[model samples]
Target: MAARRPVDDTTPHGTTPHGTGYGALLRTPHAWTFLLPALVARLPYAMLSLGIVLLVHDTTGSYGLAGAVAAAAAVSQALVGPQTGRLADRHGQAAVLVPTVVVHACAVAALIVLAHSGAPDWTLFLAAAPAGAAVPQVGAMVRARWVHRLAERPALLNTAFAFESVTDEFTFVIGPMLATGTATLVNPSAGLAAEAALTLLGGLAFAARRDTAPAPTGPAAPGVRRASALASPGVRLLAVAFLGLGTVFGTLQVSITAFAEDAGSGGLSGLVYGLFATGSMVAGVLYGLVPWRSSARRRMVVCYALLVLGCSTLWAMPNLAALTVAGLFCGLAIAPTLITGFTLVETLVAAGAKTEAFTWLTGSIGLGLALGSTAAGQLIDRSGAPLGFTVALAGSGLGLVALVTMRRLLLAPAPAHRTVARGGAVREEAAPAARRG
Candidate 1:
């Protein structure tokens, strides 16, 4: 008979390859209890985002201004992210989430009222700022909870993230469609208003769950408090990677719409995004189902190469179907890279700082997209979609360069003992023998 696998904290339950990891998260009762509410909370915000852009653009007849408003929200989210993450880390998710949800609800209502009242453009932007700021870091918080609830099995953790990523993709694709339908059938603002209500309900429902508490992964330490999760070399490199990739994605979103519109198929923008989402969704699931056999370093290198290739193809091709195919293939890298990066982050930080660390990761991606979108939009105004895609492809290539440069810091050999302080700073002290090995 085969030797029985060791049973310990890390593997409290036996590892059933076919039945384990991401598959278990969805199948388990406890996991779904938390997952359901998170999904609902995200759905409305997703809808609200698309609805606002379409509604504002329709009302103002200026896509540029509408784009500006959307970008402003991204800025607000980035600005408040660290603090919000810290709050969730120190106090708890409920402590941070409850109030954020309440404020977000009120802020959205205010934005709608202001927009309808012929509020000045600047005033409308101001109102939207609060809405953006008030939104909770639900996605990050949810992921953190998984770390606590499923601490023993890193594979399961990977699956949870995979599940979250796919859910987000689905929401973006379906939510926008819902908003578009509502806008056509009723009024554009109607969809946004519906989003506002749904956001409050969904965010609050998730917050109310007892299981959604923040997890403390490592020891707490003083230095961890001031250290931006971005300060960690691993995290910094990952952030740079995200920046490049997000720029490509952000520019592509804007440029694709322009491409379709110029071709007299304006509605194709939604279809294009849908294709991208489908690719990501399909890839996320596959990434989770496949076993992780290679070392982290090798895996990341391969994944990044795939991403670079996918992006490069987009730059070279102008055909809509071809672009979509390339995008789908390129999207395959996103979830795996993110999962690996976040796992590395988990190993690097103290327990107290996990929230901030992950928040910074998410924030970096947000910031990159905002900057990329702004720059790409400007470029499109001057040059056009082909040039925009070229710039995006180049940006992604640069990310690969950044990753290659940091190989030593990231691919360092594991230490024997890893200790985390209260503030979430980590120190690795290798045993003399382990170092010798």
Candidate 2:
């Protein structure tokens, strides 16, 4: 078992411990050990979709097929991810992750082989399906651990979540460049094989850290029914908002690639696209370090509004250079919006339902990715890259609209109390009672 550090009662609410900064969380026992592996485990989340697109398109010479296959994989993940997270909540991360990793790795390996062998289109989709269904929800699991470990220190918990968001942005920045470079420079099979290897190694390493894993929620008491996190109007609104964000991301990826190809710099698409994440990552790190006085919902609204404005700039960028600049500005809003959304999820759901809630949130993003990719691909194919930008702009506009209309639903009553169970003892903590207007 990991060593338990008692919370410093002297620290006031909404503040970190008196002498420690956000950096102190990393110095806490086993923090780096767990975080490094989890980071590795999540790389494939960024890699696989783009990797599949590159691999299938290079082999089949059809962007349509490539997009459809990628969309299928994303849809499968969205369908299966929540169930896997629920199992992890009822059982444990190691138990759920070990088998799922094996299946996912095998599926990815099969995909590489099938793509290389000039297999039929149907066979490619067959290989892609299991990979997505079995992809471990490592990000959600890691956040759950943070929540479990820092339940008593709300301020530190917020910092930890910010750190996780920054890592996510970092993964996208690196993962795409790595995938595209490997596939373009070496061979498509090699890129996917690398992804498979990383998934296995990282999943195993993360699962080995049993000392820090949260205890399973186990079975509910007999005759006692529990409501799902989705039952909350706030959670539903947040999911829809996330769906919009996902559409922006998905469309931006496909559209940017198409735009780069049209500009005669296809090879630079990954690097050019990475600039977007670079901006988000820098912003996320800075966002995490500061204390914010605004409500999470308000922050989300402002960020979404900014996102729509940023994406609108894309429609006018006549070349890759201008688009890259627009991408940097567009990325500025992503991490802040996502951080606020996840923080709201934490506040809206019961502790027992956290892992599942996070998964559902992720699943919603996957659904949006599927929808966005499919629509953007067709639009780009028929009407060119400009129309693809329109899709992203429209999606962002919808998200901003949802936030404004549903702001009242999100202001519904927060739970009055929260319970944390540790070492066979149950402790009740008072939930913050304030609601933002």
Candidate 3:
């Protein structure tokens, strides 16, 4: 398919003939219409994850089993992400999202029953699998819409992604606290039910928006699969970066929990995670505000350097307080890296493949986190929490290495253009940096 040209926003009614750019992008009737669901959908994920260990422990009376159940859900999501994305692409996001929400609701209901009914461990695991499979692709779909709406405004697009990443940190921080606290106060099973209700509400809210729909694609020619959207080299490299980052995130979460247990302050794990999230949230807002004349590649290199320094500090810290400080530093880099990388991917990917590309990206993150979290859990069990932290730091280093090696292939120049002003005047303005993988 031919590349879609950016729409000129200078037109007299603030919209272009091709219907592209920031003005057109934000022209939708309700901006929060998209943001609300995106924000709400995060609640279920946060609650489900935070409550998983507690619920499973209550049901099975095994920490090992609880951790395993968590891993099972992560793996299931990873396995199905691409398939689900493909379906969303072939049909539409609603076709996949609506049904998935129902499945998720049913699955949540079943798991609650299984947890309460003294069901066998195997049955509980089996019942949980389908629910994991039903998670809606809200993150992916919202991003796809961003691409579709902001096709002409790359900078705004980048800022939007940065906002999304920040929101994710905020959601996780609050979601887990709410989930764990509610479960402790009310009942473990109630947490899961609450997540079910949130998922339905958030997923439906996002689906209800016209802007949230997938962009129209080129008619499928012979021998084309919907998954082909993510086949580009740029998207694939972004996926690799996502995989590395996801592993780092996943391993860090498990290690922090283990560390809390080892320090005889298991109760403080959620608090520390909250601190980490707070730091990231603060950094995210600042990231958008910082003025930088350098290229995105430069920004990426700087961000990675900060991340490496922060991750390495974990090994140097000797106490929980120091570790929390280190986590804060590391957290600060999370949104910047993700925002820059995803924005770059959005620019490079084919217009028609936006949803699929994002799905692959999201899937890479889910898979990496799954593998990292599970592996970290096992390592923590065997060696200890510090060793797990060391392992996590090593993963971050590897990600930095990967980013450096691929730097040349990944950094595409930002688009620049000169325009002829009316009355025979001439003017030149640089387009937002052209994103390339």
Candidate 4:
């Protein structure tokens, strides 16, 4: 398969071709058409695990069980994610997403039914695996589209990635509120059902935009096997760092809920977590507007350092108010770190391997989430909520260490050209960072 070159005709007339501004990007033809559905499709990513925790605990009366079920889903997703990405890369996004969304929605619906039916505990656990596995990698696909659309404009690409990061934070904010509120106000089953409906609708809508999708790859040239993104030393280190960051997120979600339960305000857990996401959302928007002089690697390190400092402060908070404040402070670093890490991944791999590479990153986060939720749940069960904060602090510390120790690998220069396979022709262009000032 040969790389696809950028199409000069894609950009609409009267748009600034070289500008990194958001307005210019949004004004581009079919930009919002692609973004809106992708945003909707990813709402489940924020809701599913948290909804599972709430629903299972309400039915089974055990946070440990709830966490385990959620962890099961995360682990399943982690295992299956790359394979799904591979399929999307080799085939097409619609070919993979349409069927995957149907299975995922059905699985979620089944889980909801089982949860409400007083079924065996094992049944819910068994059902959650497929639900997670079927989750569409919306973020990666969207990023891939941006790579295709903005191939010639690195600055605009950075802005687009920043926008995507903000969208993720926004989804986290909205998803948890929707999930928890539905569970608390109506019924747990309703929350899951809503997730199912959204998954089906959004996934299909996103997939229907076939024009924006990347072209399917043909067979690799003889003696030129595609390199696994995980095999790259830099990507491996970055994945470990991402894993630790995922642990921080998973632990915080479960721990905050435990804290709310202890305070007799369990219904407020979503709001509290949403506030944390709100901080990151705001930061992501601002971060996108600025043109950074520092490299993505340096920016990532600084973000992690700030995150460590923020998480460390949670240890001293005496009440929910303090915890909320600490959470907001900690969130400031989250989006920046994620955006920089993803940008680094874009720089680290060939264009043909992007979806798989990004999925590997997502899988690392899932692995970390599974570990964090399981560990934090046990700690909260045995000790208390405050101890879970200690676990989060430790995870953040580990993430910082990983980034620091692997600084050299991360700082390596990005490839100078990327070969993209499109429509039986190969297109080569300057690497992502090559055009950056």
Give per-model CA RMSD. Answer: 7.1, 6.8, 7.0, 6.6
Q: Which candidate has the top score in lDDT?
A: 4
Candidate 4 residue pairs in clash (backbone atoms < 3 Å) = 3-420, 3-421, 3-426, 3-427, 4-420, 5-427
* Candidate lDDT values, in order: 0.67, 0.80, 0.69, 0.83
Model 3 C-alpha RMSD to native: 7.0
Q: What is the RMSD of candidate 1?
A: 7.1
| Model 4 C-alpha RMSD to native | 6.6
The parts of candidate 4 lying over 4 Å away from their true place are 1-18, 221-224, 412-437
- Name the better of 1 and 2 by lDDT: 2
Q: How many steric overlaps does candidate 1 have?
A: 10
- lDDT (tens digit, per residue) of candidate 1 on 9-117: 1111223334455656766557777778888888864554455566666677655566567666666776787678877876677778888878888877877777777
Query: Which residue pairs does candidate 2 place in steric collision?
Result: none
Give TM per candidate.
0.82, 0.89, 0.82, 0.89
The sequence of per-residue lDDT tens digits that candidate 2 reaches over residues 366-424 is 77777787788788878888788887888878878989987766653524567778999
What tens-digit string does per-residue lDDT give for candidate 3 at 164-221?
7778788768876676666667887877888889999988877777665654453466
Q: Single out the weakest 10-residue window by summed lDDT for candidate 1.
A: 4-13
| Model 4 Cα lDDT, one tens digit per residue, 189-221 | 878888888989999999999898888775566
